[model samples]
Target: MIRSMTGYGKGEALSEQGRCTVEIRSVNHRYGEISVRMPRAFMALENEVKKALACTLKRGKIDAYVQWEEAGGCAALPAADLVLARGYAELLRSLSQELGLKEEPSLGLILAQKGVLGEAVAGQPDPDQCLAQLMSAVQGAVAAMDAMRRREGDALLCDLASRRGQVAQWVQRISERAPQVVDEYRQKLKIRLDQLLEGTEMDAARLAQEVALMADRCDVTEELVRLSSHFTQFDDALAADEPVGRKLDFLMQEMNREINTIGSKSSDAEVTSLVIRIKAEMEKMREQVQNVE
Candidate 1:
């Protein structure tokens, strides 16, 4: 199915140990580009996350953020630098004796001193478990992103289809009116010739030859047929399941070329107006195709 290049998704996982969250944001881009932000410990998982995202997303500028939180983990642990605390106490007592001070140091005074206690926590995270939880979060985010892309893609497809139908309708109208243009020109030419040759003998063969040549010069059958074929190809490309942005763009170029050729060859005002409308629709489709993936 067609996918849009813009979307947003978020995923979260919670366990007994901690909670993990992942958020992804994407925007239209010519090529796929992924940037990730996570804890230093989780940096090794960036490659895996990027690979997973690339598998699902073909083209976009994607940004991902990951965060982890541990509950009831750091508060219960006691400080580890008891030796530093004892050393501070011995020094304080010596200072008191040397100054002949009478006040005694309390636990609050010792705890308030710098380097008396350590705040660092000790524990190694399980790589396998962390990886599993991260993958789960990534999967959820991927699903959400895909849904948004699909929804936008559906709207785009509908609009494109409608425009295609309109162009096809214009092509039909042009085809019907094109032949009449040449016929009208021929009749006008014949009338002018008759007026110029009034009361004079004229060669019927020469007049017929001149009209035939003029008709050939005004013929747009080949261009119309080729334009119809291009329209068909464009429709086929739209219905395709894979990335069709490039193909649709190429088809539009061909369609525009055919329309220009027809407009230049056909001198009728009505045909020219129809060609203009087709060009307008083609321009809109071209803009939309840029966001498709």
Candidate 2:
């Protein structure tokens, strides 16, 4: 199924120890790029997160963030090391008496020394359980993100279909007007030649040859035929189940090239206007294709 490169999803999982939240945001990119942010202890799981994301997404610049919050019941309390604090105070007092400084250090100054405090309040989480919870949250977030991508993809498909129809309409109009352009050129050439050779004899064969050459030079049948073929391929790629963004982009380039050539070769004002309209639709289609995967 088609998927858009832009979307957002968030998921949370609660446990007796804490609650974990995962949020993912993605934007259009030429290739797959994943960035993850989580607790320092969970850094080991970065490879796992990238593997999980790769299973579902094909292309985008994706950012994933994870947060963990501990409930009241799971909070840890801080404690000071009184023995270490006393040892430091005794050592400082002995040094002061030996140096004859006659000064006593403040309680706050003694407690501020390193190792005078026990371990930090918060303890390390159970690595295995935390990994499981993180995986679950990430899975849920990925599912939600896929849904949003699919929804946006549906809208893009509709827009592309409408633009494709417009391009087909313009191609038909150009085809119908092609023969008329040749006829008009032939008539104009005949009129000019008659005026230039008014008092001289004109060669019928030479005039016919000149008209045929001019018609050949202005012929857009080959370009129109190739353009129609490219349009068909574009539609087929859209209906495909796999990633078709790159394929569609290449087809759009080819289609635009053909349209530009037709405009340059066909001197008729009407044909030029039709080419302009087709090019405008092609540009819009190109922009939309950038978000497809």
The numbered model that scores best in TM-score is 2
lDDT of 1 by residue, 134-222 (tens): 89999899899989999999999999999999999999999899779878877888788889999687788887788788778778899
Candidate 2 per-residue C-alpha lDDT over 42-157 given as tens digits, one digit per residue, 9 for 90 to 100: 78888898889889988999999988777554566667898989999999999999999988977988988998977656555665668888889999999999999999999999
Each prediction's TM-score versus the true structure: 0.78, 0.85
Residue ranges of candidate 2 with Cα displaced over 4 Å: 71-73, 76-103, 110-121, 199-201
Q: Candidate 1, which ten residues in sequence have the lowest lDDT sum?
A: 71-80
> Where in model 1 is the C-alpha error above 4 Å?
72-128
TM-score of 1: 0.78
